[model samples]
Target: MSDLTRRAVIGASATGLAATVVAVGPPATAAPAPAAAVQPVTRGAALYRRGRFAKRRTRAFWVAGPGVRLSMKLVAVTDLSSGGARGSLRSFELTFRARRRGPEQGTYTVSRSQFAATSLFLVPTDASRRTYRAVVNNR
Candidate 1:
């Protein structure tokens, strides 16, 4: 081939080989998640901040079931914090009042409009069987 034609062919072949290598190369490492992309706390004491539930006292939360949704009122919030700091909560209890009876004692999906659904283990507290309580103990 002519010198100019030979150089052009070599350049084209190099470009083609680089493209093929990239197309068949190993997967690239993913960039780390941004600060704003922080994941939601699914389980733990961190998920149960006393302020979130205390401020919503008297509001309603829905208890999700297999085929039904039960409305329960957040009747009270008792701060059982370990008193380690001014506002730090180590433990707390949430009391909910349901109009009708629900499952005796088990983990059910509890949801509120202000936040995502969360699983909570509720137990009937009173003989009337209308009040339910869930304790989130971090201490």
Candidate 2:
């Protein structure tokens, strides 16, 4: 944020009024956000579902956060394009669950193929919950 816009937001917040600033061009003032309205969040937010998940060519993802106690599992794995005509692969799609009491992490290790891909699906259990995607790099 720029100086002018930051000042405006602060000023409006002090007066208990909503303020909006255009992130594209020069700063412009608008009304403040609603008391119970949902707002869009940017990357690297401290949310538990997706703290700082980013897609990569090598790794599926490396994400971690604190949502009190949490559980993790390899829900699904799909190989859309494979050079080999037919073959069995390795995966713990089910019957794999790890629980953490404090900070937790969701990651993977790809040893057989050079690359693997999956979507980090998330359901909004609460108003702050969200979905995320990850990438794993072994090269």
Candidate 3:
């Protein structure tokens, strides 16, 4: 064979071998999605205390403007009282669970500064439920 033709044949064979090795290798596995960062927060506390706890989920602006985004928050409140309080001032140790979804388009974020008050909300009882749902179009 001519020197140039032999070199070209060798190069083509090497490329074909590399391609076959890649194709025959174990199937590529997709990376697992990262876990979402979450922090439970108190919502509509004062109103709740005054016997005005919103029982249903909150819906955001759909009619206000050409909303690119609509957000809703549902904070399920439960009275964890087993019996009457021993003292005159009756107050049960309260826990909060907050779930917020839909804020702008690509991403949703909430910082501590936005909240009026924040503390470590421990919920061993699992008294609240949080959820998020998205669809391509209104349904």
Candidate 4:
């Protein structure tokens, strides 16, 4: 073959080889496995010191606002009886730390009956800042 033709053929072959190498490169590594699910906190019925019942699951919902976030802990749930019927009631305490406001803590009582739940919020103003009570009723 002529020198010019041979040089052109070699240049084309080198370009093809480089393209093949790039096309056959190893794939990227697989993504990592997802994190495990967190287990829910369960306080047995015995802690209520009330009537007998099965184990109940207590869950907290963290609410985030403009400049503050509240961590509410489901501390206790008690069954209140009025008349001959029983109702499910829940007591939750909220501890809040504000970015530009004062730190505050409060207790809320929530009650659920049939399909409705209500919460009453209370704050302490005296030395009794330790414990606060709320009464929630089902509608």
Candidate 5:
């Protein structure tokens, strides 16, 4: 009705809202800190060290892609390092076996327990045997 009455009503409404918010209190916990962003492993030679995979001899690599969820076994891990002009040696190869002869040559997200997920360009060396190879050469 009057300005004074309107002001009084507005003040009461504001105070009520503030009280309701305070009663609710903060969240039980701080959300959960989102989730630590996981940086995909990019360095192939570093991540898939020959020594590490060679010893396991039974590593399982899960390939993630559109309409593709394949579990390939790590059949072999070869060391293809050679002496360069400067005597630098950095090269290795990983051989994986799949159940079917598909998922041709392309970049796939491969994941294993030894390291984080990484994008590896895979090439099908033998379609009949369902084998894939990924050569990691670091200069």
Candidate 6:
């Protein structure tokens, strides 16, 4: 074959090889994302029969002594009864207790829930019995 023809054939073959290399190249593969952790929930009659007991957490506290300070925590507010207007938290009760206290003459304040906005003032009614009365004022 002529030199010019041979050179032309070689150039065409190089171009075809370049095209084939590009077509057969491996595609990009994305890395798999990590799996999320899942938490299991209790179900069945315990959910319906227990009702609030199933979803709500019950807390208790005891106070003794003359001068003692106590605090209550507002955990969560849930609808006690169902099948009412949506976005209404009815039959909701605040859960809290005075922190344990020993005999002493002192006064403490209880923080109210955001929704209810109540203020409770605790005062020792009896010095000997170490008993207190919580005065609740709903704002």
Best by TM-score: 1
Query: How many residue pairs clash (N, CA or C atoms closer than 3 angstroms) in each of the candidate models, in the order given?
Result: 0, 14, 0, 0, 0, 9
lDDT of each: 0.76, 0.30, 0.34, 0.38, 0.71, 0.38
lDDT of 5 at 76: 82
Question: Any idea how many clashes model 3 has?
Answer: 0
RMSD of 5: 9.4
Clashes of 2: 14
**On residues 25-139, what C-alpha lDDT tens digit does candidate 4 reach at each position?**
9788977655432222324433332221122224342322234344433344444334423544332222222123322433332323231232234443335343333333323
lDDT of 1 by residue, 64-132 (tens): 654547899989888643443444465677899999976666677788886767777788898876899
The 10 consecutive residues of candidate 3 with the worst lDDT sum are 130-139
Candidate 4 segments exceeding 4 Å error: 1-57, 63-68, 81-85, 88-120, 123-132
TM-score (C-alpha, index-matched) for candidate 5: 0.56
Rank candidates by TM-score, best first.
1, 5, 4, 3, 6, 2
User: Residue 89 CA error for candidate 1 (Å)?
Assistant: 1.7
Best by lDDT: 1
Query: How many angstroms is residue 72 displaced in model 2 relative to the true structure, after the best TM-score fit?
Result: 3.3
What lDDT is reached at residue 8 by model 6?
A: 91
lDDT (10s digit) by residue, model 6, range 1-139: 6466888999999999999989989877976554432212223332222233214344323322224334433333344333433333222333333334333433333322332122333344454433444422111
1-139, model 3: which lDDT tens digit per residue?
Answer: 6567888999999999999999899888987655443333445435223122222324221211123222334333333344533221223333222343322222232222223332222323332322332211101
Among all windows of 10 consecutive residues in model 4, the one with the lowest summed lDDT is 48-57
**What is candidate 1's local distance difference test score?**
0.76
Which stretches of model 1 miss by more than 4 angstroms? 1-41, 81-88
Per-model TM values vs. the true structure: 0.59, 0.18, 0.22, 0.26, 0.56, 0.22
On the 0 to 100 scale, the lDDT of residue 17 in model 1 is: 97
